[model samples]
Target: MKKILSFFSYVFHPMFISVYAVLLYFFLTDRYHSYQELFLIMIQIIILTILIPISMFYFLMTLGKANSLMLSEITQRKIPLAINAFLLYILITQSIREEVIPELYFFFFGALASTIITFLLIFVNLKASIHMIGISSITIFIIGFSLHTQVNHIYLVATFLLLTGIVATSRLSMKAHDGKELIAGFLVGVLPQIGLLSFWL
Candidate 1:
């Protein structure tokens, strides 16, 4: 049971949320973007959100700044969160343009907003579960995307809802966060996506 819960944590780590969201967006949309274009976008997202962050995490670990990939410590979160926000800013402004992919653009925009809020919350000594934030954000994005595209993705949404519960349970079982932190993270993750729905949804 412990090993299974731990697997969920790694599988749904916050670092991979953007890629998952992007892939799901492509899957659900009937957009006319070519395979080549979609491939390029995926490469860009992987490089920025995954590759760079992983490299930085290693460097931070070597420097004794970050102890784990989970960034379980509040102080360890600052630099990574800042880097994430900057990268997300770059992604939205330069790569995922609203003119081209409005839905994805707003999805990432909402992601950026959530990242900033989570980072700000650090100052107040609050450590909301990044796991919860990541899972919930993508879950809400999936919901919003379904509505915007008018696709009946009820099963997909239900699957994510189940995954959200699994993630929450995993975090709690691992002693990574309390219920309050999970709730806080869930709210932070969903609110921005919900708020940004008017623009593209």
Candidate 2:
């Protein structure tokens, strides 16, 4: 049971959530461009959000700057979160400037905003669960997408809800966070995206 929970935590690590959400959004939405263009976008997001950050985390670990890949320590989160805020700022600005998937810019922006808020919250000595933040962010994005398109993605919504529960359970089972931290993480992850929903509509 412990191993299974750990596997899910690793597979759905916070670092990979944004890319996964972007990938799903691209595939699920219409594409007027060629397959190559779509592939290129996916590659860009994967590298920017996943590959680079993962490599950076590993390097930070090697340098004793980060305690673990999980970022279980509050102090360890500062540099990585700061780097993520910077990178996400660049990616979203570039995407908007290029007018590529302009409609989806809010999702990326919401993620960036959430990261910034999370980074700032570290100063107050709060260590909310990043796992919950990642899952909830994606969940809110999917919900927003459904509302924007006037389509019922009930299944997708339900799937993420289940995933949210799983993530919360795993975090608790690992003794990484208390219920209060979990709730705060979910709110911090979701509220930014919800606030940006009006721009999309």
Q: Which candidate is the best by TM-score?
A: 1
Question: For each candidate, what TM-score against the reference?
Answer: 0.98, 0.93
TM-score computed on alpha carbons, candidate 2: 0.93
lDDT for every model?
0.92, 0.83
Candidate 2, lDDT over the whole model: 0.83
Candidate 1 runs further than 4 Å off: none
List of clashing residue pairs for candidate 2: none
lDDT of 2 by residue, 1-201 (tens): 977887778888998887688677776675466778767777878878888888999999899998778888888999999988888888888743326675568888888888888888899988888898899989988888888778889999999999999999898888888898899899889999899889875
Question: How many clashes (backbone atoms < 3 Å, residues ≥3 apart in a chain or on different chains) does model 2 have?
Answer: 0
Q: Candidate 2: where are CA atoms >4 Å away?
A: 96-98
